[model samples]
Target: MTPLLDLPSNREEAWRWADLGGIAAAAALAPVAAPEAEFLDLPGAKLLFVDGVLDATRSDLGPVTLGAVDPGEHPLGRRASQGWTLRLATDAVAEPVQVVHVATGAENHLAAAIALADDAAAQVIETYVGAGWSNRLARITLGKAARLMRSVRLLQAAGFTSLREEATLGEGASLVTTVLGAGDAGTRIDGAICLAGEGGYAEFGGALLTRDAQRQECAVRVRHAAPNGQSHQLWRAVAADRSVASLAAAVEVARDAQKTDGEQSLRGLLLQRTATVNLKPELEIFADDVKCAHGATVGELDARALFYMQSRGIPKARAQALLTRAFVADAMERIGDETVRAAFVADADAWLERALQSPSRSREGLGEGSR
Candidate 1:
């Protein structure tokens, strides 16, 4: 039997800004049946999990090794035993792999571990949905010279969700992660990546849209423990209707990690008077020969640009949507996969449409403070 760990509360520094109390309350709700899988047609293999149980018939996994068993870690890893297991071997998968998590009115706990063999390369897409609380943990390891690209999309409409990911990179290995999130009552994501071997590289970026009292937060930490490691992180958030969005990141370069290069940027857009956003980007460098930079900004739309568009005969609603889409595209355009990028942008467009429904705020008297 799997045992639950002592869940961390808001008192912890890592979870200080999260809505842990609301998440716990939602998790205690009565359990309901799992929802049917909502398919996304793509040129890739599929792995389906409903309510923490893997569905073999719907899963068309390829050469990758997959099963459900003990992850051999702690309480969170133990959840993998109750959910799905995926491992990559020698071959480079031609198509991306899709993993879907669907839930209903219950607390769903899921875990996934991806281990890449030497010289292997693969693409993976993960999607989460439904109206139930979820706790998901993923741990990954990259062998020498391996490459992995992962994309995540969260459209949980309403519920409490927490996602935690930890990864270690090997010599010359590379890992890229892109995320798109929206439509959740409360969401928290924590990510940690370690450049454990020399010449490793990691890139992390995401775009989020929140509205109508939703609370969304993402915190990521990247550590360089070896020489010649490199990493870059970029994130954008748009909030409206009393919603709150936050992005926090910490980059650390060890004393021995000479020649490390790291960069981080975070930006937020406020579409309503009551909307709020918080951004924190930090860099800790003990190495003398390293280049690291970090910055953050929060503001509203450009009134001048909006007025020019309006003067050009573009409808106010359409102009707002177009500008909002372009704001998020700054980060979304970094995605390598065209299909995944387009899908994420489409979701962002949907969000912008909803955001435009709110009454437009006047720029008068507010000055620079209006934003």
Candidate 2:
């Protein structure tokens, strides 16, 4: 029998590029003590899952289906994660769902899933708290004709590591996944995005900031299974001190999947000479009537821009933050929803300012950290 650790924890692919197993050990469960709830400031339906169990009392709700669940072993009685049988088929106008995965005190693996009704629309805010606890694995899914806009933010105290994120979108479905990472802890996130729909679209974006000996890694895959599907991915990282990071994005457009449009880019800014970053952009196309391209760039911050900002009344710290925000602002700005764009950009800008002031920035390297 295969050991549990080798069970495709769904995090291995991203880890393949970076050594994320920190010297610290992992806890078996998250704390049961009441944790201060940092309600996501956005307006939406919220759910709070402490550790691996749903905390009804702590949760902000929209009706509750209280029960125990396991991804490897489903409580609803499923042998494996698969099929349209698991998701809905009717079009749905989805309100945002904010999920707070908190490790109050104990530690355990956390897993969650979502099956959208066909033609449904949803926005999800996924956050992980790294406050002196061990937490691993958070998985989600979207059904046919469903639309999802998601963001995963990690703000843990130093010393955390290991994250497994998996998502699958069916026919005529669309998904946008974004991540913002920070802290002195060591952590890694593995992402898998599958496009099973024809004429569907998927956009994946993320940024990471690290300091000290902290380490973070991200691996993403977008597969075009049906004809005329579209996908684009952008990932960036900023490291300081003796920090290290790795990111790779793989896009596969299957044969017969005609007119597929895909593009991916990974770029970063190194703040210090000790920072280390690795970026790999890939495209696998078996279709003849498709357009696909990928590339990676690593370099230092623009000195001229920095100098220009300093020449003005702007302080160096704030100026650096502005540049960092500009690095990823275009991506966020392009989002069509005015409300979503405004709120998300505000949060992103705050993160960029924090990254610039962290003092762990690398002066020489490639990649910019996201706010």
Candidate 3:
């Protein structure tokens, strides 16, 4: 495979903003090889990627035929970075494919690929451990009538430089993806989803939390190519300290396409002084008689609501945590699972507790007016 580090570095191009080339700064640092997966527990056929290599002993799903795992070898090369893919065999409903990525080293780079066969049904979960010290990339593809409900848990890896995912949905296929990004340093998720088949539908939901200097940026673009296709995106975020989070999403409906129903909402919560957030929702439509809408909001804790809680003797920190969770839980409900969704909410609640109980408020500007 050819090694191409010629990937673009500027954010001027829509595709290059906050790219992973920054990882080049420390790429040569001795990367600790990922240790043996001793006690990890997962519920599906697992494909494990560690230290940029596929673990044979710990990985249950065998390697894909005629495929490359390194991003540097792809046709796009470093320009678009690299991603993994798996083709689910036609009408094959293999076991749930769980992508478990555990990170323990530094200066690491890796990616994973999966494709669900036509009429396949499976669940996928991505768990990232170790400090966010590596740049991880993944790509997921779905075929006709293929259903993959997936969740990505961004463990408290503060050393990671970037995390990006690219996904495509085929004709009459469906994908529901949830992103749980609570802790990480300078993490950016970029996804481009295409609906190429009629009667196809896609849903994208995500929750992001950032504190201190940690930054999380996610951008998703969904294109509706066939008529009667639908897409909806709901994203919520919380930022504190000097942390920053931004989301820009757009859904496009091609000209002459009708019977399309789609909308996007990107909302954020600023929990402390000096926290920053950017939200941009876009909808591009060239066809009339199609339904599409978009909205975004960035604000601090609701003062009136917080005061209401404090009036009931709840400490300020506890009250803020409650409201923040409640605000994010509203979208958490859209995930459509009682057991898993509840567990996810519980995790978010725990994260919010840690976020609130910590030194979230930047001391430098807590005493003065600030955004």
Candidate 4:
């Protein structure tokens, strides 16, 4: 029998607040057969992966090619049994592409690569569903003057999910990423972006919602390797019922990367006293001409706002749900596709309903901390 892969320990900065024990337990289970495919109602071309393998019957790959990815030596890469790659030609504009991963087994690993030529533009959507452990690695590259918009949704009902994304932008290139994660089990996301050419731009916005002892962590790093690069990070997390949610974001500017503009904003809301939310924002700038700023805040819902709503005849639970939805609206707006955005919002609303219906338990003080 093959030995299990050693997962990251809590000592690691990225995994410090992750549920490593739960991840390990899920990783130990053997891979099972792929479950029947139940596709989502998403527009544009679609590629469906069932249990880490491509489902040809259900996938309309268009320009995407299968068996083209070269998974490296990373732990997730080693476990990946299948991969896919997509490339856009110069000046080409294609309809949105959606990739869905459905995990029915105990362990599943997958890899994907996306690239755009000069002046090309495209939108991509990635969705994860079903149970078990799903580990995915994605690499994205943008040529000079290219543009790409990417969105990720983690909608798994159970089991752990891990995703790592690495994106590089060229001169005058642009990349925007929006993520909505509402999985019942634990989730870990590691993202890195590099502005390799002058005038490159990258933006990331994410909203994470956890409840019922669930946990989620996201760590992202943006590096300015060239002059006149710009980047921004925005994240909102909501935790309830003893759950924990965390976001650690960092920005680094090289010594010669002058005129770099970077900003980070992180906010967390706790619904119950036992719940925890952690936000850490860091910046290391060696360029004197750069303008960089970071801010983080963690607290419970505003009692004043709740009271005001209740005073106006709104039920307490309904008022709480309304406030929570409004809190994450900014991040959710980052999705460029209106239809996709609406679908995401509907999912979030459902999660909020379920979360608010649960009885609240009171602890001593607010379980909120930020750095």
Number of the top candidate by TM-score? 4
- lDDT string, candidate 4, 1-371, tens digits: 22455766678776688777667766665555554544446556788987788888888988888875666565554565468887999999888888988888587788888899999999888888877888998888999999999888898877789887888999999999998987686788888899999999999878999998899989899999999999999999999988999999999999989999999999998887678899999999998999999999987878777778889999778888898899888888878788789878987898898887755432332222322
RMSD of 1: 3.3
RMSD (CA, Å), candidate 3 to true, equals 4.2
Per-residue lDDT of model 3, residues 83-108, tens digit only: 34556678766545556666655545
Error of 1 at 164 (Å): 0.9
Model 1 earns a TM-score of 0.91
Candidates' RMSD to native? 3.3, 5.2, 4.2, 2.9
- Report the CA-based lDDT of candidate 2 relative to the real structure: 0.64
lDDT per residue (tens digit) for residues 1-371 in model 1: 11243566667777778876657665665666555555566876888877666778988876445555444554333454545445667655447888888767667787777888878888888888776777788778898888999888887766777777788999999999988886565778888899999999998879778887888999899999999999999999888778899899899999999999999999998887688898999999999999999989998878788788889999777877788888888787767888888788887887777767655443321112345
TM-score of each: 0.91, 0.81, 0.83, 0.93
Please list the residue runs of candidate 4 whose C-alpha ends up more than 4 Å from where it truly belongs after superposition.
1-3, 28-43, 361-371
Task: Judging by lDDT, tell me the better candidate of 3 and 4.
Answer: 4
lDDT of 1 at 310: 85
Off by over 4 Å in 2: 1-14, 23-35, 63-89, 132-141, 334-371
